[model samples]
Target chain A: MKTTELESYLAERRQLVQEALARNLPPPDTYPPVVHQAMHYSLFAGGKRLRPILVLAAGEAVGSQPEPLLPAACAVEFIHTYSLIHDDLPAMDNDDYRRGRPTCHKVYGEAIALLAGDALLTLAFEVLSRIPATIPPERILRATRELAASAGSQGLIGGQVVDMEAEGQPVTLEKVNYIHNHKTGSLIRACLRLGGILGGAGEEQLALLTRYGEALGLAFQITDDILDITGDFSQTGKQGGVDAARGKATYPACLGVEASRQKAGELCAEAGALARALGPAAEPLELLAGFVLRRQG
Target chain B: MKTTELESYLAERRQLVQEALARNLPPPDTYPPVVHQAMHYSLFAGGKRLRPILVLAAGEAVGSQPEPLLPAACAVEFIHTYSLIHDDLPAMDNDDYRRGRPTCHKVYGEAIALLAGDALLTLAFEVLSRIPATIPPERILRATRELAASAGSQGLIGGQVVDMEAEGQPVTLEKVNYIHNHKTGSLIRACLRLGGILGGAGEEQLALLTRYGEALGLAFQITDDILDITGDFSQTGKQGGVDAARGKATYPACLGVEASRQKAGELCAEAGALARALGPAAEPLELLAGFVLRRQG
Candidate 1:
């Protein structure tokens, strides 16, 4: 697909995800409105909705319609948004801003922010279990298990633990890769797998999607690292070079900017090839790989 | 059942749950061991395993064996432990001690404790999804959704939010009841409902178990308030009168000790009657109502 075509495709998918998320979330006026408002603030903070989009695209690739897949998509986004909220807390990354606005904790205070994250995470599983009765219970169970495992201690939280420890330390290439793969890669990969499972992909198709997800996840993080160095504050939604300021381990920090860009390019190409193996319906996935490679924010 | 027989039964069930928890948790030596170790520290602390025992007794009430229900039992305990960890954070209650020892945050520092809580919560859903294939997927899914709802913004977290806001505000009895029902009662209710669902309860039986749970839960919290005012640190495992010191609302604070005791007794009696209605198999649950009412800590 051409650049304009991919842009339109992304815009359409993003809008679909936004509507589903708004519908799935409790309203801002939910009782004890502070926590609900905090949850809404972070969730609707104009994120790219990349993970949910991946869910929809992967489901589409496996012959499932978007409507059937929207709940799973929203579930993944909730998990992603919750992780971001916690990651930006005073006790965690200590960020004051995210996505061009004050972070959740900054607006709602630390305690409410923390509870809001917990609420969103709990809601994610609730959403998954509430997937329509039209889908097989076994499939929904499998999808729920996959999402939980990916978000659990051995996955996302584990990565955050290591990443926190590695800061200001002379981390090796292997350590940086582990951090990147776990911190960001696991959820991204889970998004693809969730889509495939809910979309009724066979074992072979699922395996192909998993491999594609792994490549795409790695490439996406590398691009993020490069963007932190090269992109402007307006485009990136946060101060550039903040990673370097904090002595955070990143591809560009460890391998140099030129080498990091090359690595991301190779991974995206591999991801695109894997998407091609899934045939014509995977065209969006193929384009998404390119989009990740070229995204400024 | 005689008190001695009930004591022995409780001891045996507690041991069974302890063993199950040990088997289900990742070893303390898991990679990024700090978070896992933090999880272990809070989980193995010498508190009564009230929630999981409720699960076992409730399952037994419906004539289900312990083996199949172990995972669900452990899941509830994990969620309970996680909430305690987060609740003790500096930004929350900031308690330095719990269960006669340091809180998770006090031992592991704020960041690790926070992540540890998140990890445990995620693990709960993962464990639920992995409930034995012998149980129907639909039942497991229903249980999963129920647990999440009870723990979400409208449930446990919601209660915490309101409780925090009500501190020093001269809250009414209705508001205090809302806090108790959501923060403590929701999960307690979930435990019984989960047991009933996993044990193949009919709708009518499930309804009875739920009402039994509601009464048991409220009685349990009222007793907790009484204990906090009258029990010693050595017995209750934390400082007494901390709630009043924080200007926190509780049954005793709202209605005075004599009235609080009367309230607890009435609720327990109601709960006991409901348990007895479940037939002879619910004898342990019948006994447990008395256990909650009369416990020293």
Candidate 2:
């Protein structure tokens, strides 16, 4: 796929995800409107919708239409959003701005913001369990198990705990890998695997996709760390150089910027090779790898 | 069943839940041990295993073996424990103690406490989806959906949101009921309903259990409010009269002490009647309702 085609594909899928998210979300008018409103405010805050797109794209790669996979896609996004919300809490990262606007806790009070994040987390499982007709129950169960493991202590939250503990400390490659793999990589990896699982991919196909997901995830994180230091602040919508300010463990913090970029490029190439090995249906994933490697924000 | 028999049943079931919880929880030796340690700390801090007992009893009422339902029971306890952890956050209720021990945040700091709660919540669905081999996948999925909805914005979190908003304001009886029913009632209701569902309950049996659950939950909360005002602090494991100190809304606050007691008695009676309607197997539930109404703490 060409750059323009990939852009159009992402744009189109982003719209689909956004619409489904809006439709599925509890309306702002619901009882105790503030929580739903807070949830809405944070969810609809402009995002790349990359995780959901990965879910859809991976499903497509395994010869399934993406429509039936929308619920799982939305679920991944919900989990991602909840993690972001909690990460930005004053007790956590204490960021004032997200996507160039006041964070959820800034607009809503801290209590409501916290509840909103929780509700989103609960709702993710609810939505995942309610996938529309034709998907088998065992498949849903399997996906639910994967998602839970990904988001739980051994996955995303586990990564976060280690990351926090490691803050202001000397860095090691092993620790950095553990933090990045869990804190960010697990969920991203789950997205693709879930898509593959929903698509009824065989063991070989699933394994290939897992490899692609891991490479892509590592590349994505390295790019994020690079952007944190060197990218345009306006485009990134974050205060550039915040990672170094906080002394956070990052790819660039451990390896020099050039080495980190080189590492990300290698990962992107590895992911592209795995995607290509999956044949013609995996074109979207191939483009996604390049996209992550080259993304400005 | 006699009161002594009920006591034995409760003790046996509580022991079952505790063993299962300890076995299933991630060990503190796991990578990023703090979150798991924090989760383990709060979960094992000793509370009556009411929700899990309700699940087992409800299953027993419908002629199902309680062994297959242990996962669901443990999931309920996890959700309940997570709620307590988050509720005790400095951002929320700022509770210093729970179950006679310093709260999760107080012991682990705010960040690990928050993540621990989140990890527990995620673990709930993970464990729920992992019900033993004999249970049908559809039944597990159905129960998972119910649990998620009960815990989500329109259910438990929704109630907490309204409860917090109504704090410091003069609250109407209707609002207080909404707060109690949603915040506490929903999950309690879910525990029984999930048990019934797992037992392959008929519509009528499920309906009866729902009525019993709602009435019992209301009575439980009212009794709790009364205990807060009138019970011995050491016995209750709380600083007595703290509800009124915070100007928090409670059944007694809305209905006055006499009326609240009168209301609790009526609810206990109603719940007992519903449990009785479920036939001989529901004796445990009947005693549970009565126990809720007459408990000193």
> lDDT tens string, model 1, A1-297?
777887898899999999999999999999989999999999999899999999999999999988888999999999999999999999999999898899999999999999999999999999989898888999999999999989888899999999999999995899888888889999999999999999999999999999999999999999999988899788889878889999998998889999999999999999999999999999999999999999999
Question: What clash count goes with each model?
Answer: 0, 0
Query: What is the per-residue lDDT of model 2 for residues A1-297, given as tens digits with 9 covering 90 to 100?
Result: 798998999999898899889878989988888999999999998899999999999999999998899999999999999999999999999999998889999999899889999999999999999987699989999999999999999999999998999899998988888888998899999999999999889999999999999999988998999999999878898889999988899999999899999999999999999999999999989999999988998
TM-score of chain B of 2: 0.98
- What TM value does model 2 have? 0.99
DockQ, all candidates in order = 0.94, 0.93
- Looking at model 2, residue B243 earns an lDDT score of 84
> What are the per-model C-alpha RMSD values against the true structure?
0.9, 0.8
The window of 10 residues in a row where model 2 chain A has the poorest summed lDDT is A232-241
Residue A176's lDDT within candidate 1 is: 89
- For the predicted complex of model 1, DockQ is 0.94
Tally clashing residue pairs in candidate 1: 0
Candidates in order, interface RMSD in Å: 0.5, 0.5
